[model samples]
Target: MAVGAAQYVRAMHTVAVLALDHVIPFDLSVPIETFGRTRLPDGRDAYRVVVCAPSPGEEVATGAFTLRAPYGLDALRTADTVVVPGTATPLAPLPAPVLEALREVAARGTRIASICTGAFPLAATGLLDGLRATTHWAAAALLAETYPAVEVDPDVLHVDNGQLLTSAGAAAGLDLCLHLVRRDYGSAVAADAARLSVMPLEREGGQAQFIVAPWPATPRGAELEPLLAWLEAHLDEEVTVERMARQAGTSTRTLIRHFKEQTGTTPLRWLHRARVRRGQHLLETTGYSVERIAGQVGFGSAGAFRERFKRTTGVSPQGYRRAFGGAGAA
Candidate 1:
């Protein structure tokens, strides 16, 4: 194994967070809180996290507040992993020094990532050529327009293509970091960290969930609020357009038309996905066994659950659990 990999396995991984000037305070805190708080099976610190910047040991305004980071470029040199968080200055050209440091680290096979719009600095190194990545959803179009060489997918929460990874904005960074912990150490360790942070054990739902949230059920008010609440409550039941229309006091045609206009999807597809999402949450957070989980999620059998789970995520419930449930594979 490489030195960094060895160190990581031994629970001595060093994560260097590069904080540029005009940092977004929320982005800076995600890694600091998530990675710094992880622990090994014996409760020993699992990582050595240092907040470094272009000008180490200097004070910089973080949009919300000023921060004093102790490590500098040197920390980047020795890091087992380096993370660059998003900044308010999304298109600001990265300094040559920052580009050089990231390039060197990539060359050495040091693990690296960027959160939110932080992909700008990492992309400056040109290592992301031909790789699929994402930034904040709102920036996806610009990122693709600016860096035509990069494949930008705006829907997923994050893409972990081995040494290089990128995440969507804000809270999605938590999902990506927890994913890394699960990948490196095991699910058990990641679950502990999630519990500590008070986040979901695994959020398999993609960023599409967010991008698709606002417009869905828009023009929402008393007439539709009760219906939506009903949909969420009865995902496990075999709900049809006819039933939904009657409940909403509309005919089937009117109900379908309004739902499609608001949600950009047919009622059945939406209903199916709601069940899948509910199943995803249950799979990640519970140990009810596959049969019971399938029944609870409205699947008639374990086979049916496995089929839908595979179709949606390209993985089985057991596989998803192994990846996100903090346990070895079933």
Candidate 2:
């Protein structure tokens, strides 16, 4: 007599997440939340996300909490996609088992990803050698120095090197997730996911916004501080270049030089970015009409606001608001 056997069919997008000691709970969970939350337009799940570890039923210590992974390294062997999140205990080298799994998965045409400093593990595998990648801005320098073969850029929120993708940090991971959805299913599915999650359709800007309103790492002298604060608080004001120069107690030429030196950009450019950010905040967080948000953010009127917003963010203000707004039914 033959024993009855059960076979499991793998999902097309099998996402395997590596859970190690001292895992960042939030980063590690992002893949599970976003990918698991998604479904195909046909009402089927888009991906299967599994959290796996070295051995079956292994326990992992996540700094603040202890968790058990029901699956083993075998899960990585057949995964269509693998994701690595930053670990709290990354000072140590990756475990041999984990490294082996990464090597095995990647050799089979599986796409590998890193969220934030997860690049560390991937870089160690040498797959990212000579590939353009990025991590959190705070780690870009370290990543470059640590893995000379990887081209690291800290400016953008993330970088997509085809099958390999890396994100800046926590929230940037969300952007990368949505980007993957857009790539796989087109903008419609991704937009629906954004709507379901109650998140912005897309991020307004890059990780550069993480810098700040007017200050860089090295603080400027007290003279420019008050002016920047004023500009931030009152973006609606008619902030002319001449006015900024006067407020900084310098000529426009001198102000331009100082602004470039301090912020790596002209005052005008910086102010434009700030206003766009403000406009985005208003759009997402308020129920105000587009015209009202435009005026409130110093756009002078809705049409001008649309033009400048599209120029800066590549989408019209109304579109941006529609995407980001916790809006009532259209």
Candidate 3:
């Protein structure tokens, strides 16, 4: 009999994290924390994480402080995967030796991923040419301008192009690392790692949500806050733009304008996202039928709920539940 992916084991996978000078501490720590903590069902460590710099024991500044890596560039030669963390000076030219090493490893079929502005160094290696990639939304424009051959998508949390991948800023690194774990083992293992990190195994939407500005501190915006709270509390009820306007003491036209300005989307669209998020939580924690979940989350029918859920999350409710549902789920 063939072993299932989650049950199959070989020698421990080696993940080498490449930390360069002026590395961003948060980006440097994400993969280390995520991969270092993952465990197989048999209670074995899932991966061997090694932090490597261009020169081991050399102090690398992280804006806030400096530290030394135990391994050197040669470690990349033996790694199954290589993760490059962002640096403070992302646009700065990469050291020739570092760039050469990355190209060498990638040529050998070693998987490579970048966190936030780390895309700069990866792009500098020419590996991202003609590939879709993303970085911190704030730096997306620069990444595109500097590397016209690379497609920079500012809206996604990450882009996986088989052998190479790139993640958006900050916390999106966690998403990318979890995705890699899922790709290597299975969703059950990835879900366990997510629980350890106190994060959902798969977050809805993308980096575009973070690019939106927060509600301005104005009277109109302030009123919308209470209206939003009310909407959440009444998600199971029939909601309409007109009803929302009435709750906020505004005309429907004005309410639409305020939502566009403050939330970067129409009121109904926001409600739909909230409903899908609620549905996901319920599916993860309960044994309730999909029809029951749809009704509880305010969808008019199960069919409509399934359509919207898949559109928003790229998976069916049942599929998501199968992957992430806890012991309480049926």
Candidate that scores best on lDDT: 3
lDDT values, one for every candidate: 0.80, 0.78, 0.88
Candidate 2 deviant stretches above 4 angstroms: 1-11, 212-330
* Each model's Cα RMSD: 10.1, 7.1, 9.9
Angstrom error of the Cα, residue 136, model 3: value is 0.6
TM-score sort, best first? 3, 2, 1
Model 1 regions lying over 4 Å from their true place: 1-11, 212-330
TM-score for each model = 0.63, 0.64, 0.64
lDDT of 3 by residue, 1-330 (tens): 555666543467999999899999999999999999999888879998999999897898898998999999999999999999998899899989999999999999999999999999999999999999999978886787789899888778999999999999999999999999999999999999999999889987677545432222122346578888798889899999999999999999999998876655699987887788788888888899999999999998999999998876667888878867886743
lDDT tens digits, residue span 1-330, model 2: 322323123435788988877778988988887888887777667887898877657678888889998778888887887889888755569889888888887888888889888888889998999998988766766677688789876667788988889888888888888888888878888888777766776887666545333224333445556777788888887889999988878899988887766555688877887887788787777778888877887878888877777776656767766666674433
Candidate 1 lDDT score relative to the true structure: 0.80
| Tens digit per residue, CA lDDT, model 1, 20-119 | 9888888888988888999978777777889998887679788678888998888999999899899998788888888899999899999998999898
Task: Estimate the TM-score for candidate 3.
Answer: 0.64
Clashes of each: 1, 0, 0
lDDT of 2 at 286: 78
lDDT of 2: 0.78
